[model samples]
Target: MPSNDIAPAINETQPSFNLDDYKIIVEGSTSILTPKSEADVFYNPVQQFNRDLSVTCIKAWANLYLNPKQEGKEDIEEPELKKIKIEEKEYIKKFTILEALSATGLRAIRYSKEIPNISKIVANDLLPAAVDTIKRNIEYNKASTNVIPNLANCNAVMYTKEFDCIDLDPYGTVAPFIDAAIQSIKNGGLLLVTCTDLQVLAGQTYPEKCFALYGGSNLMGHDATHESALRLVLGLIKTTAAKYGKYVEPLLSLSIDFYVRVFVRVHNKPIKVKDNMSEQMIGYMCHDCDSIVNQYLGKREERTSKKGKPYIKYGLSKAPTSSTECKVCKSGVQHLVGPMYGGAIHNKDFIKEVLRINKEEHEDNIYKTRKRIEGMLTLAYNELPDTPFYFSPSKLSSILKISVPSLKYIVAGLGSLGYECSLSHAQPSVLKTNADWNTIWYVMKEYVRMKEPNYKVEKLNENATGYRIMTNEDIKLNDSTKSISFEPNDMSYKIEKLRKLKMVRYQENPTRNWGPKAKPN
Candidate 1:
């Protein structure tokens, strides 16, 4: 039996009830419900006869509003809920979410049911049946009192009252709804959009089809079909939002197995093109060797370097070029990769606020909520760095000796706090210079302070060969045994163990053989 399957139980109070009496069909499967009124039975042949389709749709809504994931699985697990709580805590009191293509009331029902104190939710669907279903779902879930469902086509913008968040999860491509969705979101509002038409976006088919769906031309000789899809969607969304005098910065974008999801923040103030737009960077990947490089262009740099310039004279800085030759490619790079959405996932202050709200409103099990939030927030803070950037957690873990999940939470937390962050493929420890080391050290220091204030930090010597701890009065040497040649008992065995883990490295002349020493057998 599948994990989600449940055995039917007899109800003595309802003698006429039979599990097979009424078939509730949704997208793909037929579910038998115990005898119920016709109104209670929901059957939609378009949904492929699956009763759980409605439930899955509701789960997607909840995930986006409260606990969104890069992947499109349809279950609202505990991990996802924790993420939602963390988001709610930071962006409280003033946030609004617009369900641009809300079909049936699944998404609205979940939002109203789960998220506490969500100021307002505008749920709109084009079909009358979908609108009725949305209303009915709200009422059935007892969310009607809190949620307001609307009946409209994709022209939801006509009813827009300037929402802080706009979610576009259409049946296929979100292209038709883009213009309206962008116009409706308030300045600084968040937009959550999903695209299910993978074939068009992935560039496996026609260029016109891709353009019609994603609003961007497909590039040749690139395996970035998924990335291209995201960029195309983002470019289209940005263009649409610009028409309304709103500039959108894609804060988070992920291409999951089945679809692509993007979350962008609207900026309505004086464009601040120099500052915000200047930070936008792109990463180019080598088609041959898989080596990647990140390039950042300032607004001024873009303006000054409009036309190619010859070699510069002494004392004058040459204008930076938009395109650079990939060291790995050895051939001229063909693609302009991304201003890929990068940002923190969990904000600390926001999470604290959420906890306060939950405590004030609900008297139920807030402990679990708090714990989950804390864990997620901690992970985000410790692992993730500022965005409009990139950093690979896997590489960071290799250097730091920490798990990828631990780093993910930290990165997510930092992202949620409004910090720009990215994951680089480069190893954190092997960063090119001392400046990089200092930044890492500073980040680690701050993280330690937040996570464990009592933790001690020891600095390595200038030679990078050994380090001494003031707290423990221990001295570690740079030999293979990682021998501690100090007063009292020498813990050479323990020192070597730490060295073998590469947690510590030795500084030497000519070549720096920095790494933990081998442990004694």
Candidate 2:
């Protein structure tokens, strides 16, 4: 960390420069000066949502951990529920944040202005000109008191003191700094990580590179591929922390346009860290139907000791829970895909807190992406917490050669059968539901019967997925059977409920070239 004298030196040093020659970019409460079009890479307009979401998550975490009045879902008395069970002396009332890869110090300055009760902010970069620009901007924005600009290696963060929050938002993979952040963070500290190597992380093009970095196999060409990216990063973080007798509680994990961002809290609990064996899973994913079956490494069961106090006991799961072929659509092959993090990625209670904070604190003009944030977070809160992945209605329909059903119709069918359903924030077209493969296939078959009752089933090959489903006798399904009814008459209400939602669920491209910018010379 930078010394106390550095603050006075920064205040006294008059690096003569005029803000008039630079372009002023205002976002939230901080206005940064960047070199015109040439140096536009210094700031990315694509990450406005990233920054806006960060401010809200930090505030919620602070309220949950720093506030004397305990709030949120966790009970205060539970020893395991305590935010940071580190020694009391290590718990600071005010947060000390470090932005390791601060490009133009825009994000650091925003943190200084947006999040309350911050004792110091260290924005480090390797370029001298960048450091000078940070100092000039701090002076211009009147943020010198909290924002400390440093000229050193962005990863030279192995200092003696630990920070309350450590943000790593490098342009690419954060592999080099994962261990350093894991070791340097104070217990119960927040680590904000961004991986922009969407190609590698999503396993879209290079599955080998994905495995090399994340230690998990890649899942390419799937509806949940983006979420698979998020899980891969989380799995890496979880394994790294577990090695140091720690565990990660993911507050929020998002798969944005071209990157994956996660907000995780690292806590020191040797016993709980063992649960990762159970929390992580290997997935059997079907390429054709987009159906996924998770095979957990282990299982955690609640048991009682001799004295009758409840405790968590970790054990192995039954062998070969799934077969080699896709059970839902018998003709499709099941590929063994993952060693991904299988735990609840979002803490619903924390999401609720974030939503509340956004509504109460962040004004509309300052946080321009407020509505999208609300829509996304609301979808996350409603997601089935135990479900490992999601499937697309279109993919399911394509295999059965049936007319595509509206998203509302799919939701209604599943909801009517007592299965919970929600839209995925990662992919708008996918459905995150608790319905089993058998029920889901039945629903599709039922839809096919109602729509194309007299269609020539004999035309399909015997090995085709549609033909297999039409001949299956276990469910009493046949080519012309119409025995299935959509069980109660009340299912139509689900369609109306979804229709009433008037929220901005996804972002359309605002510019022709709206993605990661090239680094400036």
Candidate 3:
């Protein structure tokens, strides 16, 4: 009965506890029990999206890596579907998960019921009340065999045993648990991490605190700070894992509502770990105009071995990729910004697998945030692999003091000259392109010169960023400027088609004062 999809309904038989003292919550075929007062423990309804995405990703990971079930083995129970692709080779790996801070057991319950081949899940919490709630929910839902309730500090539990997957979704920063989780996870295991303290990770107001926690600096006053937070978290993990001759490869990194979630796989490869410096970088940002540049810590080059075999040679990188004065906008103050993760944040192959899993209609409505997940992953997969960051056409329009050009126009012009342009899930109206600053400035000025000639920069102040940028002779002298077209060619038209689709490409706040809920008092 415990292995069945439908848990026995409450009140079907008498138990020790009074039914009226609590309430029932149903999410993805799993019902959980919570105190009526809610002050006894915490649950945030907004995190339903977080849980939905996690289940899908875990399923994808298992499908890609696990071995097939033996002929005589009994299949693991899953709530809405069969236990993975049974015919595939990846159906048999025992998935051991540690929900390191499962407050009310909702996520743990979902994992038990939804993700297949999960041998055990330690629904861990330091609070006795939370553990008591978990035990009651596990029994009520008939999930005792799949989930093991534990009362202990998260780090204490992680130190004692290894898990195939460790989820560290804590109240605030995930920094304190990073090293422990990395060390305790089995080689090639997965890590699901969430950091709700955006103020500490993304806000410029507390550089000391950000560095203390994540060991990095965020982009100040930039629209893309959410993405910077994602990178900082990944950077912290990459560096921490390297301490034990391990390396982390980011499978999926996302800046969800009010927080950031990243799924990374840890592997023990000393040679791969040696590439850490190349994966990390420093950013120089112009405080006023918001122009930025990055300098990687090291470089990798293709070298031929003694036996004529090709290999990658890794060594030091040159210093100071940017000058103290902003090159594009000469009037701004240059600020040293990051030691952020410089590698590709999303694995294209892994995202393709997640997208394939997302398309399944077995229980589509169960994934409440499925639409958003699809759009975001599509954009992520489209991003140029070498581009480290993004800029919006609005920012460029503001700098030149011209009426904004349509996002399509900017993207088309870049694509005409053979540059790859795509949207970023972090923010709408932003372009992640392979185009240089010169090409960008040329295009914007070209838009003004041909389309909005009425706006003039001649009378502007000499010390303004706009004035300096507009006067740059190189932008004016570029021969490509004369032949550029604002009209979308086939390549640009393709990107625009994706924008036209009926997808939730971006989301607005669902309610006033919507953010992380407070911990139970």
Candidate 4:
């Protein structure tokens, strides 16, 4: 395919195929040559937010390590090995990126035009048409110098070369490419992954298939199954990297609309791989009660020897088995949902840094979804202190047949009880907190029993999961309850602060029938 092989001018034979080319300006910098239709090559307008976020994240990542200052560091010499000292602030100028599945080369071109420190980007695709479209798009955008369009398989190309950054945004599960991606990245590289197979990861239809691909069980019963999906993918990456004496440190992991995206920093450290054991855990979830207990498959404890050397003891050699019955519900058997990455999904400093860049460097209008980014990042930052799994107040209300409480009330009430609480960025109605299911239920029950005296309690014991663990302990409502109040652990004034920044809570459909897009026709 020639660099100028753009679709022929609108004609009877060509039928346009929605091939009308247009320019899209993002972040006040990159101007992408994009097509209107997907009949020839793939392009999703809705995922502009994903692409926009990626640009900022990559820039921040590069600025931190690539363009860093040396402070009192001495070069060490190894007797058995040759020591190579990185020159001060020289290698940081030219960074290489690999976009494994560059359908139309939009992302690659944008990186070239937008990211100042980027030197080269290899945009690859297996489809001949996609390869041709990428080349033409690159030519149209005049990004030929930086983005090299390739006609090759993503995995094959990834396995052959190493890069400072590798992006895997496949149409479905990234399982097949994960190993190759792990091999493709250098010792201290960034890997951004996107998985669109939400049905397999979050849906309950195919447990066996999910296990086969992710080497972990899916939590069909858990309301936050989307989060489990992210963790499952991370677990796969960590396990694959560990096989090569490498480990993954997730900087940011999120469940955006219809898919999951994660940014991870990979490092080569066999000794630190033991940290993954504590980071990986199996979730014991009760189908009846929605109670979740995380049991680590691997355990690590620090010990001191007689010579005063500190060492870690690992106790996880085998896979964990499922429990016969739920610890909370007792009647229902607990479903084993993991062997997934149970570590912190997002790095606070990293996300904060991204937020800072998004605000300080980029303009407000061109980025478009900047406010929502702030809201979401705020929620993510606040939830950092809470546990992994969060309970949905609306789901709990439905189970108990009570009026759904406002998100503010639930959070404030939890805080009053000395428990931390925050809204989940994944789902607006969901609440992430350190309170156990019992305490949550007790609080809700007390609120309901006080407000609606007519509602019967005798019937709840049989149908409501809350009743199974609900105690008669009286929760003294403080004077703060008299007025409608709102407070988040992140110390934000109220949920309104986030909700007021509308359009950030959830993205509006950019077009009709928008979702996991179809392959190029």
Candidate 5:
């Protein structure tokens, strides 16, 4: 409803014109007027005309269809077509796609025309008139002549094909069609879905109401609402897939201004599929504060000793101790549901393969495609390494033979690079204060030794607590004020040099309130 200055002006000759509410123009001597609410010209005019006269709509449609890339056009047709072409080449010959809720079929028409060797595409819709229009569009475009058209509601369409890829762009949340959509996909198949009800998904408006429609949890605060909606959708998909002996691996998920789109890969292998649904129950989240606790229902047994008596415990029959208390009303526990899906987006090899295919086929735009593929692959790869704080920082420092303060800097650096890490105080002071020191130190040392042979280290002191390793003088911390200052001597210069190499970081004790005092790196 926000004013769009670029939309075409209405045809003045037509007396019932409302420029603000509709867009009208002439295509090959035929009047093509579309109501603002209904962007598709095919569906708006079909009911008014009989089958014999409906051909008029098709004739007018041709000009708009083929010339979408004309000067100053605001339509989605051409861009979507280009994207399909890119995806097709990247996926290769075995790809199977289903437009689960096709209305007038413009998207399907564009896909068939643009993508080459797209093995199969099923265009479906619930209405008879829409189906008829789709058929007409297919014939008019002369696209994949073999494209199949199905007449069924979105849910029923899922029963027709076990597709390798499925696209769901319903008018609203697409919630009603999700279970069936998951069932329709083969293992490793791609699922692309769109949720257009921004108000509901974004959580600016009512939350419980949104949950009723979307069948998942809602978040209330900042931009997290969008992420919450995406996670909710992913959780629903995972739940549905689990019922049919499958698990969904999220490939790419994003939330734009007014929509949430997710691309996930389904896995149906016996091992990946959980035979006991109970085993899949992973955790419960506090609806009020977003606090999460772990639970396992899988068939794992353990023996426990209480007051000198040992007893065997069976699988996840009861809940574990609450991980966190509700931050809101400070009362009643939130509900638990789902063996929700979790993991990185794409496999590194799969992404590499996609990039190679794009490089060979789309030689002109290979750089652009490679960049996108690399970004996605990097994000997926980065998300998979368990959060940094999962390992004791002090223990990590011991393994890497680095000071705890230096380890903190490494942890903070990794965090700034978009890694997920947490700090814990449950372990000993030496073990608890370090970051992911071992991994960071190894990677840094490998890179540095390969790049700079001049840098060397010597052990100064060794004890039960920890050991001090000194590097050559000539390096310094980039942000000295944030780090501890060594005696401003050769040892200090060496420490600073190590900091520059990202081999260590300065850390401060969280419990000690020393009035913002700097710690050594």
Candidate 6:
């Protein structure tokens, strides 16, 4: 651990800069002194939502560990819950947090003041200026008792110290620090990570860089590649954890604009790790038809022992194939991406608790993302089980040469056909569903052909899968089969409830060039 104290002489001898150039600002329940000039230090007022969400998530994470309910039991009595709260307070006094790569120390100070459960926080940065600034802010906020400022390489610090919670909100890919973070967090501790390298993860500008950093290729043309970015990050974390006989249970994973964040509980159980090994998968997504197929990197086999007991056998191998060409696309080979996590991204229970906390406790004025949180969480809660990526209805419409239908109609249509579907929070225009590629295309084809004869269906590429669905005369599917007229009250209720929240799904840029701060030259 680096020393928290800096000599007064050292402070005086430091390069001359305007100390008064910075101003004190308040966020959440804590006050922070931030650099007025971006050149001096980095801070983005837009990430208030991210910080607010972090505070709530940390509280929820602490509550989960400090006040766990007995397995397979009913709700606790009010009195018993009160007793649990008392125990929780006692446990909070010992909880420690490490905010690795804390640029401005704002989040660490907030965690100290806002989160009642946090005890000690090590706010670390490699820059001497940032460390000095954090120390000043800690004193200015009167949070010196809990927030410790350290100047050191974050990877080195994380590799040495273990904390109850570890947060890594790095500027770019978190690949280099992931292994150290996995080793630093305590068993069952929460690891909150943020990666702002969306271009490499989601855009077509750098496929080789994506594969090099994340051990997966990018599906450059996929509409929902943002979701793929989330999976790829999860895959990296899972693969890294498995090497140490550990695994991650993702409590909540989110792909906000320009970045992705995941809150996961890392476990140190070899058995559970072995059991969940097959969750990592390599996906083959086709560009032409938006079809996705996943192949498991690790396969499980069950066999009966001599004593007639069943046991699982594990199979592990290197990444299967890295071909950028898709075999499923009929118009030659299309774009393919991944070798990503095929497991559940968000735990329904954790998201529900986050919602509950936000409703009952989180202050909205400061926690501006509260409505967005509710809206996103609700969407995540209603997402189809086992669905990896979503398809954009608008993208499909463009491809099929048809008008885009109502999202409700598409969701209801899929629901009525015994297929699961929901609106995706990742992209408002995208619909997440278990309906196969051909079936979805079939529904679109039939809907457009019947509703608008002016649309030239014959103009669509015949070699593509959507055209196959359009031209398939052997089997016929109409509006009833398409679920266009089916208006189930429950389905409407779920979507309406989310719509009523009226949350801003994406954050508006507070200023020009608002994004992750540039590293020092």
lDDT of each: 0.43, 0.78, 0.80, 0.73, 0.45, 0.75
Between candidates 2 and 3, the one scoring higher on TM-score is: 3
Of the candidates shown, which would achieve the greatest lDDT relative to the real structure?
3
Off by over 4 Å in 3: 1-14, 68-91, 476-483, 508-512
Once superposed on the true structure, which residue ranges of model 1 sit more than 4 Å away at CA?
A: 1-97, 118-120, 157-160, 200-236, 249-257, 273-285, 292-326, 338-521
Decide which is better by lDDT, 1 or 6.
Answer: 6
lDDT over C-alpha atoms for residue 278 of model 5: 37
Tell me the tens digit of each residue's lDDT in model 5 across 1-521. 11101112122232333446545432221223344554344432211111111122111122222222245542222222212234443421234467887765655554554344445677787778676656654554454354566777767667654665677877667788888887876645567777767677666566676657655445443323454566667767777777777777665554433466666667765555543343333445554323334454554344667677765444545656654443222325565533432333234443344334434433322122233333333333333322211233344344335444444443444443333332221112211112333333333343334433554444423422122212312122333344332123443343234334421111223234422112111
* Residue-by-residue lDDT tens digits, candidate 6, 207-321: 9999999999866878878888999999899989988998788888888867899999888777878855588776666656676666777888899999999999888855745
- For TM-score, the strongest prediction is 3
| Residue-wise C-alpha lDDT for candidate 3, range 197-217, written one tens digit per residue | 998888869988998888889
Residue-wise lDDT of candidate 2 within 1-521, one digit each (tens)?
32223233267456466766788888999888877665543788868999999999988887786554443533222232223334754433566788888888888999999987787888888888778778878877888888888887755653433677889998789888888788777778789999999889886678878888998875788878888899999999999999999889999998888889999998878888989999889888776566677888899899999999999988888786778777766745887877989989999878999999988888988998898898888778767787877888888777777677777676666665667776788877677777777677877776777767776778888888778776665543343523445543344464446536887667768688899887655
Query: What lDDT is reached at residue 252 by model 5?
Result: 53
Each prediction's total of clashing residue pairs, residues at least 3 apart in sequence or on different chains, is 54, 0, 2, 1, 14, 1
- Give all TM-scores, in the order shown: 0.47, 0.89, 0.91, 0.84, 0.49, 0.85
Q: What stretches of model 4 exceed 4 Å from their correct place?
A: 1-38, 69-91, 305-310, 317-323, 459-503
- What is the alpha-carbon lDDT of model 2 when measured against the actual structure? 0.78
- Please, what's the RMSD in Å of model 2? 4.7
> Where's the lowest-lDDT run of ten residues in candidate 4?
1-10
Candidate 1 global lDDT: 0.43
Error of 4 at 477 (Å): 16
